[model samples]
Target: MNESISDLTVRKHRGMWGWILISLLIAVIVLAVIGEIVVHRAMPILKGRVIETLSTRFNSRVEMEGFSVSVRKGLEVAGDGLRLYPQDEVVAAGATDPLITLGHFSFHASLSGLFVKPMHVGTVHVAGMAIHIPPREMRQQTPKGQRHLGKIKILVDEIVFDDSKLILGTIKPGKEPKDFELSRIVMRNVGPDAPWRYDATLVNAIPKGDIHAAGTFGPWNNESPGDSTVTGRYTFDHADLNTIKGIGGMLSSVGEFSGQLNRIVVDGTTETPDFSLDTANHPVPLHTKFHAIVDGTSGDTYLQPVEAQLGGSEFTCSGAVVNVKGKGHIIDLDVNVPAGRIQDFLQVAVKTTPVVMTGRLRMKTKLHIRPGPESVSKKIGLKGGFTLEQIHFTNPEVEDKVDMLSLRAQGDPKAAKPGAEDVHSEMVGEFVMDAGRLRFSKLNYSLPGADVMLAGEYTLDGERFEFEGKVRTKAKVSQMVASRWKSILLKPVDPFFKKDGAGAVIPVKVSGTKSAPKFGLDLHH
Candidate 1:
């Protein structure tokens, strides 16, 4: 009876202990469920903080569509459809779209850091971010000493963007805004009050090139985004100038820039090994170093000065490349060459293999080129004057004829044999180029014993030359013949040819192709 009683007592004690343990397990499960509910309810507070931070930074209103938080691995926060609008006045005026829009964004942070006044976060990954900056006049400046009642400040270690876009709004009534497509962007130490270090890659719309840049961009100026500061260095490679229709080249450049967002000062150098005009199709090496001011909003460039080299010739140019409403970019430049070679200019402008003339040259001209599909020679316009000294025709036959003419004009008919001597000429002209031809209004040519004044046109293709001129020589008509009998017979007509205080004055014409030029007397004129 005693053994049975002991066994029943032990069974009762064991059953009681098992029930207590089960009750404790159920309580713990209920507590965990309650805690989860509280966390879900408190997520709105975190969302509000994010909105408040952005609103205070931009002095605008912020809105979000969805928000979620995950503590499974070190506090991950994510959201979609975030937008920021302009201040009260702009909102009241009924703007169509928000100033900034983000499709989706996410970031990681320590759970303890999320509850702090100034939150510190890890790298933020953003996708499909678009910034639409309004015209300067449409925005309002923030008050000088305004303080936020409950501002939530956030400091980010870095921010990364896989795809983003920037649009600059214009003040012109019907003009479209400028757009820049950014492929990738990374910013470090991003905060509201300090500049952020950034590296970016983007496409250049006009020339169709790749640009990689590293820089520092502002603590933004919400009132006038153009007034925000920016500084950077960039490398632009494989820019195809053929995109402009009339020109062709593969250009490369490296540069540095600094200033406000709208107007930036840049110093750079460019090199193009095979730069060529479509009309000529003869490539020449071109290089330049320039100092310019660029208007980011309008895509205009104002060149203070550009030092350029084409083959062996050097010149300086200053001008503006501006965008027109209906047309594309127009180039207007003032060009000056203190000293150059005529052959170098011809090599790039003319289609002939060997240039017709060689000389030391000086020139000043105004150059204007409008964008078009026509040949560059047909589209380019130039108004200028040039001086050539010690000029010589490149063809041996032509040079020999010029040398014979000089010898005969100096009253030495026996010495007028070709291949016996060489002669150089001087020329000065005021010219205008249009439709692939050069028109000279005033042209003067001089040699050792003769002077000529002429006016005419020359085609750029070297296909035609038509010039009429009056040539005066030191020798009389009787002295120009080698035979004694011919000289005596011509004496009677010497007085008829004498004019302008010269022994002989003749009306002459130069007409023919470059290879076989003809010089003859034009008595009909």
Candidate 2:
């Protein structure tokens, strides 16, 4: 009877322990369900707080959806679409309001002590985003005026924006709208305090081929507004030059360029940015540096008084002022090409025709372009002067006795153009050839030629050209002169006024356009 009572008591104790274990498990599950319900109920509030905090920090309107929070871990805020607007009054015309639209964005925030403080975001990832900047018309309507008006500036900490589209438009009155589109762009940021570095490899970029760029942004400290600077290095590989020309409205012959820049220092308070470029193996291997001041209030003018050293040559050029408008910009530029070795350039222009020439030439030109106001009618006028000394032209086909000659000529820039119709549009100059003889310099052709001295003054106006000169021949060369004229004109050769076949002096006149230049002789012995 005692053994039976002990076994029954032991079994009852085991059954009671098992019942307690089952009740404990049920209680734990009930507590978990209650905790989950509480979290679910507070999610909207948590999301609202997040939106409020971000909006206040960035001074922009922010929106998000689908928020989840964990007690010990962190908050996972996910949204099908997110948007941040520049201002509250911005209205989207004919479509949904143009806000920075992110297809899907998520933020993981580190939990703070019992929700007493806002959670710290560990990482924010934005995928399949589209950022649409409002047109200039909408911006201009803002009360802040033109300077601070337009587009929402974005700041993100450690973001990954992928497969995005960005559109920038300039709306002007009475003119077609101008817009720029960036498609399929991917960007990655490192850290908040770290430089806003980006590694973007773009394919089918607007005007040309694929481009890959990796660089770091310089220090950007908002406390000291004037102390901001940006330094980067970019390389363009096999890009189309024509596309570049279309964008900048400047002619470039280069196909590829790679270079490094020290820094781009901009002082927003002072409205000036100093930039430098060190490039090589380009169309015109350039090592250029310049500083420009941006207009603080108007933002219309950019002034650059630059000095550059290119191709071992010193050049001073400046866009004294550049005015930026809706469609394009206007530039007032002055350029000076110093006197340098002209042999290489001459060789290229003339080819290898076996002619030796030596001299130095200097040029100064001005170019002005107002691209927007008028496109095709843009006027380009060139004015410059050049001097050629010790100029010579020789060929083996000519007389062998005198194979070398020297002369000089100077001309005005205005008259250099072909078919310019102005009496004053004449390139006035004088030339003298010595140390060699021309077979027909004195209109003579007797066997071997004549010892002739030639000097002339010429003028060219449009298609009309005129030359007046005198050629004097000694007695030993007078007969040669008469015979040459006879052969040339098929007439009896005789000196108009000759005494015993003595030396004769003849006055010569050459006139007419370059197309049909004519020559005449006035004999006076």
Candidate 3:
């Protein structure tokens, strides 16, 4: 009877302890569920703090539409219409514009960041961001210790940006700045310990081309920020050339770039399907393909081995453009055209010459062009030689003069069109020219009535043609300037009409343009 009573007491005691443990476990579960609701209620207070914190960092005004937290309301920032203003101190030359605009920026992290550790952001998404940099001339120079984008450091893991654009202006005063944008900007492994890789789409490139590029960049070492390098390749297909500014009407280009993003080395190829001397109207159709190797940074660009083709003409050139920083462009080029029609290529290449040329020709030339508020002839120089085969002359006034010569030399004057006339010759010359003048060192003129050695300097692009030269005729004066019916007119002009031993030499003064040449005696001689 005593053992039975002892057993019942022990069983009752164990049963009571089990019930106590179950009640405590139920209480803990209820509190945890209630905590979730309490945390959600506190979001308003937390959101205010986040806005204030960010506003201080960029020295700008910041705002967002709303905030929603996921980790029991512990840590995360979500919602849209997040914007920042970096233009507070700017006094606009025109209407005020935001320096940077962000449409939506969001990120999330583990709730443990509140107590145990800093937030380890897993992903960040930015969308509809537009960046417009101020022109250097508009802003006062930055102080010595201030931070600039090229030297700044950013800490992030993986970032994705959609519908983003960036505009960069030339920092040097007075130079035209470039405007460009990138859509679908994506970068991965961007932290200090990781190699950063990116892919993007370029909008509104030169010649109104759209480009796409893929590249690998830095785990930028903060120790030496300037040393980071970037490498990439790009393709621009079937661009509308009419939309490009300054350099007009061309198409199709591809390129590769390597080195620092701020200063890079590049090479590319371009093709134009319809090339023209005047881009705005009456465009001529000619195909041109060009390959180039370009180097240097903002103020200078060196172009070596610029090879091209247009119609039946081919050109190879090497050049450099300097002083792009402020003083305007100074250009140097060494070029060779092994074979071509002079009429087809010369007018288009210069873009400013108004003369027409005719012949099959070969040429080699060197040019130095420096333009300024000062004198043009003093700074510009051109030295070259040319060979012309089956040469024909065309200007209406010249054609009339040539017809008169034909009549005097016992041939028909009005036989055919100027280009189809049966008279032809081979000519060679060496010359020097500049923006203001062209000087022929040696020229040979051969026809049925006249074979002459000529040398002169003509005012280039001037309204009036002014030239003086020594013309030594290889034929007699009467034969050169007279016919059987015109001997009476020649005897008074030249005393050596009948004496043809060494021919006649005259100092000729020629004035007026190709259309209205007025020849007179050289009174100065």
Candidate 4:
């Protein structure tokens, strides 16, 4: 009877212990289920915070299609299809698209940051991001004393974007906004109040080059974006100027820029080893160092001054490249050359192999090129005056004729029969150019003993040359003949040709082609 009691007591104790173990296991499973439910519920709260943060920071409405957080991977957060509307109510009302959009983004953060005021995040990887800046008239201003997002702040260690773009809106109706492709963008220390350090790689539209830049981008001024500061250094590489219709070159540049987005001051140097006009088809080394202000909105560049060297010719120009409504870009420049080589200009402007004339040249001109499908030479318009000193024609026959004319004008007609030799001449002219035709209004040409005042037109193709003028000489017409009999014969006409305090004055006309120019007396004139 005693052994039975002991066994029964032992069995009761075992059953009681088994019940306690089962209850404890069930309690643990229920607690885990509650914890998961709480986490799932907190996700919505976190997403709401993110949306609110973005909205307050940009002062715009924000929308997101999907958002998710995973604590399994050390607090990873991700979202998709995010868009931020323009702050301007009027613009937002008429806009079919948002000001900023993101296809997808992901970042990692510390769990403790959720309880902090300013959450710190690791690199935020973004894809398919685009920022569209509205036109100035449509831009919205933050209200006074409302620029900051009161207390909540989110500071990013780095934000990286791959294959993004920026579109600049225009005020012109029916015109498309300018789009710039950004292959890669990285911003460090991105926050609402401080300027972000950025490194960006983009493709240039006009000359089709690749540009890499490092800069500080913005503490954005939402009210006036043009007032926001930006500073950067850039390198433009492998720019093919042939992308432009009428010019050709392989260009490279390095520069630094500072100022706002709309009005940036850029100081840069460009090098083109094979710069050439398509019409001329002769390559020349071209280089320039320039100071310019670029209007980002209008796509215009204003040159304070540009110092350029093409081959051996040096010139300085200041002007604006402006975009016309119906036309493309109009390049209007004021060009000045204190001294340069005429051969250098001809080598780049004319198609001829051996240049026609060589001289020391001084020029000042207003150069205009209208945008068109025409070649650069055909579209170039110039109104200018130039002085050519120590000018000499390249052709032997032309040089001989000039020498002969000089000798006869000095009353040494016998010596005028000498063979071809170098004879220097000087010319000063005011010219206007249209359609490759150069018209000279006031042309003063001088050799050893003769001076000529002329008006003429010279075709760029060397096709036609026509000039009519008066030639004045130090000698009388009677002394202008090599033969004694001819001199006596011309003595009667000497008084008729003498005028204007000159020994002899005669009307002259030059005509024919460049290769075979004809010089004759213009008796009618």
Worst 10 residues of 4 by lDDT: 141-150
Q: Give candidate 2's TM-score.
A: 0.48
Worst 10 residues of 2 by lDDT: 402-411
Among these predicted structures, which one has the highest TM-score? 1
- Each candidate's lDDT (Cα)? 0.82, 0.41, 0.58, 0.83
Candidate 1 whole-model C-alpha lDDT, 0 to 1: 0.82
Instruction: In angstroms, give how far residue 246 of model 4 lies from its true place.
Output: 1.8
> Which of candidates 2 and 4 reaches a greater TM-score?
4
User: Candidate 1's error at 94, in angstroms?
Assistant: 9.5
Per-residue CA lDDT of candidate 4, range 112-187, in tens? 7767767778799999999877766565433434543534456678999998998766676534455679999999
Better of 1 and 2 by lDDT: 1
Clashing pairs in 2: 444-481, 445-484
By summed lDDT, the worst window of 10 consecutive residues in model 1 runs over 139-148
List model 3 lDDT by residue over 181-214, tens digit each: 7778788776544557888788864357678887
lDDT of model 3 at residue 450? 44
Candidate 3 contains a number of clashing pairs equal to 0
Q: Which predicted model would earn the best lDDT? A: 4
Cα displacement (Å) at residue 300, model 3: 2.3
